[model samples]
Target: MPSTLPSASPGTLQLQPDAGAVHLRVAGDWTLAHYRHLRQAVERARAPLAADSEIDLSALGALDTAGAGLLAELIGPARLAQVGRWAPGLPAERLALLGTVAQALDQPPAELPRAGWGLADLLAHIGRSVQNLWRQQKQLLGFIGLTLQTLAVTLPRPWRWRVTSLAAHLEATGLNAVPIVALLTFLVGAVVAFLGATVLAEFGASVYTVNLVGFAFLREFGVLLAAILLAGRSASAFAAQIGSMKAQEEIDAIRTLGLSPVELLVLPRVLAMLIALPALTFVGMLCGLAGGLVVCALTLDISPLMYLTILQRDIALSHFLVGLGKAPVFAFVIAVIGCLEGFKVGGSAQSVGEHTTSSVVQSIFMVILLDAIAAMFFMEMGW
Candidate 1:
């Protein structure tokens, strides 16, 4: 029996110096089995070749992408492209593979031009931001229309009402929230009275502090404070709750069953909030007036009767009506925004958390914006 002699390593490279030019005789199973050895072999044999250097693939063996890539790197891209002329004995498919890899490696990558903070860049950024905001607002308006349509369809049929869910949400949104809304407005009312008394004392009109507190609370603070609180609490809760359901694909299941998610999930919450906010606002106004009365009695030596007398004389019924009137609008916007963000949730806890935060921010911002516009309108009307 003849000895194996280790059979020349599957991949082989031989460098020949010919007439001051180079001829590379390559041979072997250059597939990935010998990838490491082939790489090292190519690295060591990668000497600078004359422009006219030639490669001989006549003795080459089996090839693959990994092996062909190595061959392309070793032979130089310039010579690799014209392989048909240099190695006619090379298989066409292998020739095509080598040519493809060579072409790919030879070209420089294309890239976007880097931009600086110049006027053009600034304008472009502003344009993009405006476009995004417009798109978002359009979507919100469309969702509002959809919710109203769902409400219209669901309203005539009392059979479609989710009485239990509405009552539960009302308990949470209105009854459970009463203590905080009351306490917050009460404290603010007392502070306003103190400030008014301090400022009016110089004019011997400390009694006017009663009127001041009533006007501020009745006209602005009571409703504004409650809406802000709910925007933070209820809006975020709504987003998180529905977002979780969405992430679990429950909304999709409801749709698959030929039921409307907007009608089922959104209407109960919206109606509940609409009914709850005005009631909360009224509660806020009473607590605020009570707080002011306490402050006037203790600090200004004014009795509760006198404070009430002044409030009756100076604070018009129109002011209270104006404040209470804003609540339903605020409530509807908050609920709609929260539910919209929930519907937008992707399938992840991170998405739920993110949409919850976005809902709160959007609800509060809309509340403030609407409040300002309402204030201006009422002021102009002398309401």
Candidate 2:
């Protein structure tokens, strides 16, 4: 070769001899002109370094696919070793093409050193998880805050629209739930009376069966059973409704119209359930008491008059109030869990269905757990 390589801009090539290494020098950007000269130089040196050849590309300021493709070709068929600082600002598409060629030739880039585990890594992972949880909490709170604001404005303006939602939710949650709640409560009462009668009759205390059924139903069973039913019926409905809206882009449409779906959809339903649950619980209590009365009169031969007197003596105003108080709390919990799962609905219809089912099941589980905690607290306080 002449003092200067004949072909390209201002790059000189120097061959080093361990096995095969080429030092490529360049003054400015290495364009296609430099790449052609690089190939010619490699061809001239190939036979001499047949066992191994390394093309060092670290000096180039810029390289394109033409250059990368040429390097890929030599590294593959010629079994050359490629060592380089690839140019910055290389297009992703070109890099991907080069990676594919390298992979096809079973020439993987060298693995970088692994970082050791330390306190820093543990803290980093924990921090990320906490941050994610915080973000979810913020989203949930934002939804509630925005819902309250929108309802404050809309309820004063078009309050009647909310009434329809209330009616709809009550019809779905309360009316639809009545049959199951009534049947279950009735059976529970009958079971209680039968058990009390069986055990007490031997001791000549069968009349007290009335007191057992009345007290439990009035204070605990009525509210607990009603909450469980609503958890299954209303919570699932809320999740399915909201999740479907999310899946169908209805929530997005509400946003586009400057409306909060939480207000228009969720708050009304929650309000309705709050109002309806107490009434439903009260009805369920009455049905349960009636069932107990029937069993007491027929099995124990206690007169209905005697049953009523015993119930009146055993049940108190505070007992009724406690059950009533629990209803709204249960309503709030079911509404929150349902709406949370609903908002979790992803872009797919399958996600909508899966989350709706999970919402109902999870709400039921939470209701039971909360009820147990409440019972413990109340018992500790001598309730």
Candidate 3:
């Protein structure tokens, strides 16, 4: 038929069919301007084309890449090759463009293989997690070793000490933390005393509340509370401070200037914590005892004089020493973990925040774990 397909643009497609062959007469400004009509016409005519069909582009006008692509898609590589064998009427430029489009379309689309929800996937996930944990532990051990080496190298050199930095870190980690540590220990001591008095009053042993508070605070509560608080506060602060510096490339600058970051940044914080934690532990012990004293006076009706008498008679000096002795170890571990996490930070704000959180978690875990191990050792040793 000579009839043009219905359209709103200058593009037109006329189909003429004989017994053995079909002819597609394309006459249009087959550019982006008529792309919609051209696309619709191609879709409508696609089903009716015979295996022996010819595309007559002799009447085609104003072709563009988009139109050529559409035409290539409609003809397909096999049918276009068939047309080339018989018709040979397409212009050199149009034929080349169509050939290029055909070659591009000949490529197979890439697709990712779908993972099956099987035991293999579950095992793989667990394997990856375990691997990550082992890697992290290895890195942590290496860092601890490096820190110890640096400390050994620097300790004998009096002039190498960063006294100013150490003093500043002590003020920040120790002095600044005193109030909270004291208050928390005081509150916990009061709670313990109250619980002790309430339970012991039934047995006419309410007066023993002071001894309970003294023993617990002196041997465990004071140092443990201070260590946990510092894990949350000072450890996080160390990570954030150093992590920010790392993100800003100041760590690189230090390296450029031939200053060891571990000596300048880590040693000061470690020394400060070693000095500060014991002092804080001592303050926490006193405040906790004072809280117990207040609770005993108010609720148990035990006078301050009687409370001191009982504490002095029952709680030995060795108990205080045990608690104080754990402080430096906890402090060193906290400082090292915090500084290590900070140094691991990548160059981003998100990385700084992540490492800061990691520092707090690792510090707290190490402190609690070490305390438990120490407790077991002391118990077995009958100390």
Candidate 4:
């Protein structure tokens, strides 16, 4: 008899080969561990074996499904040329064990599924943005309502502070703007006169230069230039002032002190712009006309009286009224946008500077856009 097989425990390795068979024994609580070792040993032994090979597990005392399946896998490749057998074996159970391990090894890896966004999700996002914008619009309307109420109450008061402040703002926005406005207006008038004289002098119609300059400045250039000037000056000033207050938490402090920032700070500025812009536009128009008059008298020898006569004959009251009418609306728009942006300023000096610059740029763009729309409407109305 072969040397009496020694009692072995789980994970013990034993290899025995006879003339025609290999008897690999796995003993005691046989598991996948025993199966793997046994399979590896057989593979090593098979390299030198004939095409025929045999595996016998006759003395296996206890074996798990895992161990049983690994044994089947070792036998599978040699099934045609060799025989596979188990002692004290249950065939059906062994088959089931092999199937479980095969299925587990063949299965794909687990993964998380992806969720996709569709049109409905996009629509929901847009709806949310619109709702937020609607709330802001309501808040702006409320500010306007409160302003109207305050103005109603304040107008009846015997205080001269309002008028005095208006006068000061008028000087600041108007008087201070005079030199640059005059300079630019003069240049513009000179250019217009040059272009008009160049073209009209060909036909001995140089006298028409006065009419072109006068009517153009009175009707459009004066108001447009005035609006652009205030957009740069007052709009930026308002944004910077409010932005600084916001950065410093001064607006909050005013609220804490039972004061209305709108009344104390914002309203005065708004009123100032409203009063100042019209006066500035009026001054700008006069300066522009005077400029054209100088160019005409100096270069074209057109008399001042003749230029005034043409202005009276060609420029209508409706043109003057339309230009003046746009001033207050432009003022209101610049004031509201500048203050709103300032109120939104965060606690950074950079944010204050950014919003101040943005207020001026955005107000100027809006002023031009609104002017274009107004021009279309007035044209449609045959103004």
The candidate that wins on TM-score is 1
> Model 3 residue 31 lDDT?
76
lDDT of 2 by residue, 1-383 (tens): 54534234434445566534543333333346676666786466545543334444445445555665555554453232223134334455545655655555665668995699789888988999999869865865676576567657777776446787788888888888888899998988888889989999899888778888987888789988888888888888889889988888889999999876777788888788887788889988988888898898888888889888877777777777877788888887788778878988998989988988888887788778877888788778877
Q: How accurate locally is residue 126 in candidate 3, as Cα lDDT from 0 to 100?
A: 96
Question: Which lDDT values do the candidates have, in the order given?
Answer: 0.89, 0.74, 0.88, 0.72
- Provide C-alpha RMSD values for all models, in order: 4.7, 9.9, 6.1, 14.9
Which scores better on TM-score, 2 or 3? 3
lDDT of 1 by residue, 165-268 (tens): 99999998889999999999999999988999999999999988988898888989999999999999898988998999999999999999999999889998
- Runs in model 1 with CA error above 4 Å? 1-11, 17-22, 27-70, 76-107, 110-115
Better candidate number, 3 or 4, judged by lDDT: 3
Residue 184, candidate 3: C-alpha displacement in angstroms:
1.1
Per-residue lDDT over 320-374 for candidate 3, one digit per residue giving the tens place of the 0 to 100 score: 9999999999999999899989999999999999999999998999999999999
Full ranking by TM-score: 1, 3, 2, 4
Task: State the number of backbone clashes in model 3.
Answer: 0
Question: Which of the two candidates, 1 or 2, achieves a greater lDDT against the reference?
Answer: 1
Tens digits of per-residue lDDT, candidate 4, 29-55, equal 457546656567546654544434443
* Backbone clashes in model 4, listed as residue pairs: none
Model 3 spans > 4 angstroms off = 1-35, 48-122
On lDDT, the candidate that comes out on top is 1
